[model samples]
Target chain A: MKLHEYQSKNIFSKYGIPIPKGRVATTAQEAKQIAEELGGRVVVKSQVLVGGRGKAGGVKLAKDAAEAEQLATQILSMEIKGLPVRKVLVDEASAIDQEIYFAITDDRASKKPVLIASAAGGVDIEEVAAKTPEKIIKAYIDPLLGLREYQARDVAVAIDLPRDYWKDFTKIAMGLWEVYKNTDASLAEINPLVITKDKKLIALDGKMMIDDNALFRQPDLAEMRDTDEDAPAEIEARKYGLSFIKLDGDIGCMVNGAGLAMTSMDVIKLFGGEPANFLDVGGGADSKKVAAAMRIILTDQNVKAVLFNIFGGITRCDEVARGILVAMDEVKPSVPMVVRLVGTNAEEGRKLLENANMITAETLADAAKKSVEAAKKGK
Target chain B: MSILVDKNTRLIVQGITGNEGLFHTTQMAAYGTNVVGGVTPGKGGEWVLDGKIPVFDSVKSAKDATDANATIIFVPARFAPDAMFEAADAGIPLIICITEGVVIHDMMRVRNYLDQKKVRLIGPNCPGLLTPGEAKVGIIPGDIAIPGNVGVVSRSGTLTYEVLYAMKNLGMGASTCVGIGGDPVNGTNFIDVLEMFEHDPKTEKVNMIGEIGGNEEEKAADFIAAKMTKPVASFIAGQTAPPGKRMGHAGAIIEGGAGTAADKIKALEAAGVKVAKHPEEIPTLL
Candidate 1:
């Protein structure tokens, strides 16, 4: 649930964080108009989820509206990390007295929200962390207590802000934390938080990753989900309520659980096979879910074989077998399938599958061997 | 013995009375979980479920009445963090959040709070967990697992069951299977559960299921190399995932040369864990 820089800045402005005036444009004309509105110099940035947009020529500076339009046109036509630049943010360029970086993201090990700040900004933070970890200052916050004033001040001081700027830094940090918490973001970052020639602080660039689960609570934020940014298979998987992750392998796996799916992939590899995708139909999956999963898997042309491993619990073995049959009927897969069914009603399920003229393994090892063999044959 | 839960663990359902909440709760209770109560803000004092376990308005009240030690949260994503915190505040030792779409920031906050409070949080987007022959807590098919020595841990729910099916085909059953969930800032991590599996005598072999995302697998790989005494077989999904596309799991993404299936496999291999390249290879690796 990553947000474009413009989207993040919009939320930043709502939180009282000062940002350079900007408008997102989808066309060269729109970008030119936005640049004209901003006057003087403007920055044109691509609206992709991945970083390194600048390196990819997705971020450029324009001296005037015409140049801004030209830059926008160039950027929109460019592809950064395979995502085409559909829109660009035209923002007023700032004269920086100093550049700093600030961000709030999850620290999994500490199980806390950590705020990171650095005096060194406008470069990859990972490089800083790798070269001089001490240059980066981090503060872990208690969500219930919120980001305390002292914690914010500690970050400000650690970043070596001048005494005069400490107050403003604290204010910005607090505001950003508020935005991070309230927006249900996984990450809220402002790189190159500039100290202008007038000594006023402004967020020059913004990046945010919202929590997909929390989208239900923030309908406005949820609408920001760009389906065009997603892979077609992923969009279709979401529509069917199936968890499908396309992988780069020869064997397509359709499994019943997340852990098992990984292991199934692992087993395929151990047997000299490569998995094509990770598809989980979920528990209590009906024939419809199974059909949807098969369709998604079949979309991967790299998939040479299909593996159905069902461990029935709340999901009956027979039901999974029936679903596989249904999906096979719907998909008419040319690839061979190896199924391993166990748990409640295992026998009935095996019998149901046995009648289908598909390969069935009495054991997982047998299934793995058979699937790998079937895949090799198909290949 | 199961690490987090067993037959004796009493469970409470948060967000009961919602469609998914009620449906999964009913199925869980039927699977032999000691489901002692449910909680729905205004719908308390009513039995939406057939169980004798009372419904309470709040987690605190439910804890007081039921003396429940574990909670399974079926609340929606927005309120899930609050629900987790509520369960934590009520001193529930183990909280399994079955909700999806919880904001990672909210999870980070909730997880941080839980750390401060010393509570165990399971998932924000996961299907939950299941200890075969004891209790079922997540969305994995209960019939797929049987109480055995193998411990299964994964990020995908359906994929976990698939592995179990493969294992069952080998006449291998599971001591416990856990889906740590797919969100980036989840409560329980792969290393956390791996440590638990390492310590559990019932867990003879571990099937570590990972997907494309963060450095969790690499971290677990390091742990497996240093700490794990049992045989660890690993599989990482999304080897073929297209660049710039996020798979179903929020954490299942490849970016900046990190969170790739190849990287994870290399790390796991370096850790001395047998790596399986495909789902069906897990059984052979074990």
Candidate 2:
């Protein structure tokens, strides 16, 4: 789950990492009030999840309260990267002495949390890595030992941070690490850990992405989920423990596993058909869950047909078939349907679906071919 | 002779009293796995499955009583790390975790601890390894796979079955199939299992099932090119997956324009591993 800029900064502040004095404003009037409190000079940043908000004109500088209100109204009315600006963070502007990039993320290759720092900051870090390459410095934290004081100091030195700021840098880095570990965040970043003209270090911007699996333990972070970013059908699917991703296509796919679900979509594309969405009913799904998944799929008007690909192992084919039957009763789906059930009581599953007016295939190839044809005819 | 488990392997079950644990335990036992004992913390000194499998309180006690060399976990994600540490502390050489949704931090610690212990760990959110006709460990269905020369390794559960079923249809079977799990941080990876398969004499050609996210496939492609003599075929899912979407699997995401199916496929093809265009094409490529 990606945390918006203001939300991330709020978390940073809680950890004693200095951030520009700011409050999230949902309206132009609110932005004006915040600007007035901050002595009239502020930056209104769009609180969207996507990157490149500055390039999209979602970020603007306002010299006075009136200008802040105008900029907020403009931003709030605009959409950046297809996401509307629902909230804007009106932050007290600061004079920059220098900028440095800092972040801690899971390094998949090392299977450990890695701290990344650079002398260059503010711009896209990936772009900098792709261009300069040598400016980036990294340190891998031992999950058992955690980020040691020496490691933080080393990163500070490697990033060419002046010796005067080492103490504050280490403190901020440690605090950031605490926030990351406590929040179960996959990424905790400060794009520009800027040194102000007054020699004070503050985080200019913040971004955090919490680990979804860890949300079970981190209830507070889970509540921060922005529902506006997800499609309604995708959100509904999650309630039933289903993993659903909506795509633009016609064939609705319901499969048991993530891998199988993607493959079902891939095969659909290969067979000259498009998958409307990706839905994984998960292993050992009951009839109720199956019915929920079917309803979620049918909610998409682009779905010209529906396909069920069951390669049951722990998930019994017969159980999935019962799910399809139960779903058929409730949804009464008008779209063409194709069903392929294989492994573990597949005969029983196929038999159960025999009279459901659904096209049944013996293999995935056969199923894809049939589903493509069905979708075409439906179209 | 399979890469991970065979007839001689003795296994213990953690979280044996849970619904998933109990159900898959019976499935594994019915498939002829030597399920020596079980651990359920408080439910020790009891018996389950008609008193055929003894239950113990801790992994240490279970190991001492059953002399079980391997354990498969069905514990919830919250306590899975403790279960792994318990099994490792008991000096169990092989630990297979079938539990899913384990926190990445916990798994990272588990991975670090297991590495120091020199214990071979597989899955934490995976369908465990199946040595066909010899030992069926986790949740992979026993009927779909038969004893044969092809060794299959995948990052998915049902997708592995799809590949195995397709292989079975072509009169081919697996020596063993390993599900490495879809979590970002996992115990055994494609390279770890592929190395085992390469050494196993029963294995001839290898079938690899991969998806987007992580450079494990690229790394495996390098390993196969540099080391392995056996022919390998691979299929990478999510070829058309949109960038930045976590296509169901936690590890299966394209971040910063990296870990894409196209990149993985390109690397694998350059390494002489035939990249299958579809799931059914995997067996034919092999």
Candidate 3:
């Protein structure tokens, strides 16, 4: 999950990495208070979990407390890239001498955690990578052995960093690695790790993305999840252990596995129908879980028709059929539903749903065609 | 006749006392997989499945007693890494992990550890291997396949079943089906299974099922173009999925304009492999 800039900086501070003195402000008045505490010269950054905040005018410099409040008011009322700026970070402005780009993320090709660093900073790393490939340096770290001091020093030297700053660079690198490892972060970034006029290094901007699968152990990090960034139906679906992504269309897709769920969506569009959402009830879902998925799908008003595609392996079609029946009794949904049950106990499942006032098909192609027609008729 | 599991395969179940373990163990045994002993900590000397299969306290004891050549793990994600380590240490040549949601870091460590050993790990989140009508290791339904010359390798479970069901309707079956899993950092990849299928003489043709994530499919296409002489068909899912939104699977995300269905299809077609536009079309292409 993506953490806001302020939250990431807080984690960085906890790891002994230096960050500008700041706090998150939810309103203009709070911004003035934080700016005054930081001695009036500050940078107000939007707390949205997206990029190009500067291009969207969500970031501004304030010369004093009054200007800080004025800019905060402007940013608070602004919406960048369709996401409203609900909070801003007011940080003490510092004198910068140089900048560096640094991050640690899993390199899928190597199947290991890699530390990426460059002398170029405060810009799009992808752009730099495309422009000057030699500027980008990477070091792969074994998960068992972890990042070593020599490796960090080599990165520092590769960036042509002066010897005097090697110790501070190594410390920050080690601290960032700890933050990444301890928080189970898929990515930990420090863009523009600036060296101040006094020669102290401080993280000017930070971002951390935690692994969703590791959240069970990192409870503290999990609790920092920003609920406002997620849809309510999505949060509800998570509670039921179902993976659902709402989309803009009329056909609601419910399938047994992730790959099949996506394939079902593709087939719907191939048959000239747009899917309203992608929902997977998982490999071993029971009747209750299936009912929950049905409710979640019906919650979207755009769904004029629902498609139930089950190719049961660990999941039995009979149980999924029973789940649809249970949900039908509770929700009393009016939209048409096309059910295609295959695999284990498929015959029993088909028999149970024969008289349930739903359309039935034998193959995915047939199901898609029927659902598209049903959705068009419903429209 | 199969690449991984076959009639000669003697299998043991880890976490056999758990609900999923006991259930799939019964299914595998019913499919004619030689039922060796099981491993459940503190359940040593106990017997499950109506006193037919013995339960040992550890993989070592079970391996020593049954001389099991292969083992399937149903342990939860938290302890799954340790389970793989134990199986590797016990010298099991083939280890198939059916557990899902294992942390990527843990799997990275497990992958590194298994690299030095003479073991093949299938998945940390996958639906095991199936050698139609002969033996089954993991949770691929025993009834969906029949003995044939086609070798299937997929990154999905139910989608694989969808393709295989269509192939079966068209009078085609599998030599063996392998689910390399959906996690970003799994032990096995498309190339590993593709290489195996390319070498198996009993398998004449291959069908690859990939989704919209990673460059594994593109890499496999290159492997097919450069090395394999057998005919290969391909299907790439999630053409309609939006970028940046994970489509159910952890690895099924299109980020930064890469790992898209369009890219995978282009790569496969450029390699002379018939790319199926739909899941049901795989059999026709093959």
Candidate 4:
């Protein structure tokens, strides 16, 4: 749900927060045109989901149109941490008087949205909080009232901004809060909010992460998603309403709940095998969804064996049993599988799998041992 | 004696007409829970589950008519807060929320409002607490649990079952098992349950299950170090989960160099609690 910097800046601009004039360019020619329109000293930043773009050579500054185009071409061809740079944002470079940090994110300890502002910016805030600690000021916003005017002013003063700049800082802070609340953003960050040489404040950098659950209401923001950044299995999983994360292992796990899915992987390792992936089919999934999930797992060639560990609370064992049978009919893969169905109608479900000649275990520990041994024999 | 609920827990279910509410209501009643009434707003003055339970339009009406002492919420995420608010307004002392995916902002508001009352909110995403062979609220399976002297508290659903199953395998049983849930903000926490178990005379030992999340386990370690005299066992999950990523649960994430399994284990171990490497090892440690 993380947005690229350029996308985040666009949302920020809509809220009246000033951002440097910029346009994204996907090619070298487009870069030159954008730099020409902006004129004089443009920063070409590669748009990738990963962090540390500057150290990874995904960001560079150009003095002229030709250099901008050259740098954009270099960045477009580069890959930062295995993610290819598909687009470059050509933006007007700002001459900063000073830099400051501001962000709003969820704080579990307080169970509220906490604003973290620091006079020290343009670096990792965690490092600063761990070291100086006093340079940063935190304010918790009440969900009922939201970020109050007085709270905003307190942050401005704590960051040590001059009186003359307090009004602008407050305005930007209020705007950031609006953008975050409206977009269903889990995080909204403006690192290096710069005061320009002309005594005007601008957001030099922007980062946002939208909440996944809120995406249904935010259609415009949902369309901004880039599936290219996700693993193939993860993408397929969304279509089937399954939660799957690929890992480096041979035992393919399909469990009912999130915690159980994780525990299934851990048990596989404890039984002397590595987990190929983590997949949760969720509660009340029917045959079709299970078939789709099985096909997706079969697509991963690393999976030598599969395991189904279902603990049906809201989910019923009979429904899951039908899912496994339907999945076997559709996939027809050569790999072996160990099935363990516990809770509600488990006896009937176990009967169904046993009749299909599939290996069944009575306990999770036994299922793990069986799956690991079955995978080794398959190899 | 068991904590939270026993024969005295008169239960009213919110969102009683909903699929989850109806299903768990029947399950809880079958396990001997005292199902007094139900609430479904528009479906008030009706009967559900073949007229075994009476339905009311609001928590206030239900509370007035039945004097229900506790309520479990199964409403959708959007209406969950309102449901909790109604229960709180009705002066219900114990509220167990089973609804998941509620926005953190909503919980913050609900928490702020509930702070004024003496209500105990268990979870907005948790599988409710269970007192085996006596009363079962929430979705924890009733068959695997047996009434015994051990106390269990966890932040997960399936992992809680796994822990209880392991104990059952060793001829041990539980007095009560509570899933505080994996939400970032919840009403009851590890400390709350630990405090309850420490005071309950029938409970001899306790098992605490945590994952990579907020510092609940670490804070619980401090509480155990200072006040706990009873034996405590601990098991931390997600040992191989990647850092700084949400691992399925809204609360199960590592952030800012905290909430790692290793950190939780070290904290609990330093507090003189036996920490299990896996769920199977929990019973042995206890």
* Cα error of candidate 4 at position A227, Å: 1.0
Candidate 2 stretches with Cα past 4 Å from truth are none
Question: B1-286 in candidate 2: lDDT tens per residue?
Answer: 8888999899999999998889889989999999999999889989999999999999999999989999999998899999999999999999999887888988889999999999999987788989888999999988888889999999988889888888888889899999999888999999998899889999998999999988999999999999999999999989878788878788888888889999999999999999998988999986
Model 4 CAPRI rating: medium
Best by DockQ: 3
The residue-by-residue lDDT of candidate 1 on A201-261, one tens digit each, is 9999999987766776789998888877777998898787777777788888887755556
TM-score of each: 0.82, 0.98, 0.99, 0.97
The candidates, ranked best first by lDDT, are 3, 2, 4, 1
**Residue B235 error, candidate 2, Å:** 0.9
Interface root mean square deviation of every model, in Å? Answer: 4.2, 1.1, 0.9, 1.5
Scored against the true structure, residue A224 in model 2 reaches a CA lDDT of 90
Error of 3 at A281 (Å): 1.0
CAPRI docking class of candidate 3: high
Flag regions of model 4 displaced more than 4 Å: none
Candidate 1 residue-wise lDDT at B178: 88
True contacts kept of each: 0.59, 0.74, 0.74, 0.42
* Model 3 Cα lDDT, one tens digit per residue, A297-367: 99999999999999977788899999999999999999999999988778999999988999999999999
Write candidate 3's Cα lDDT for B150-208 as tens digits: 99999998999888888888889999999999999998999999899999998999999
How displaced is residue B62 in candidate 2, in Å? Answer: 1.0
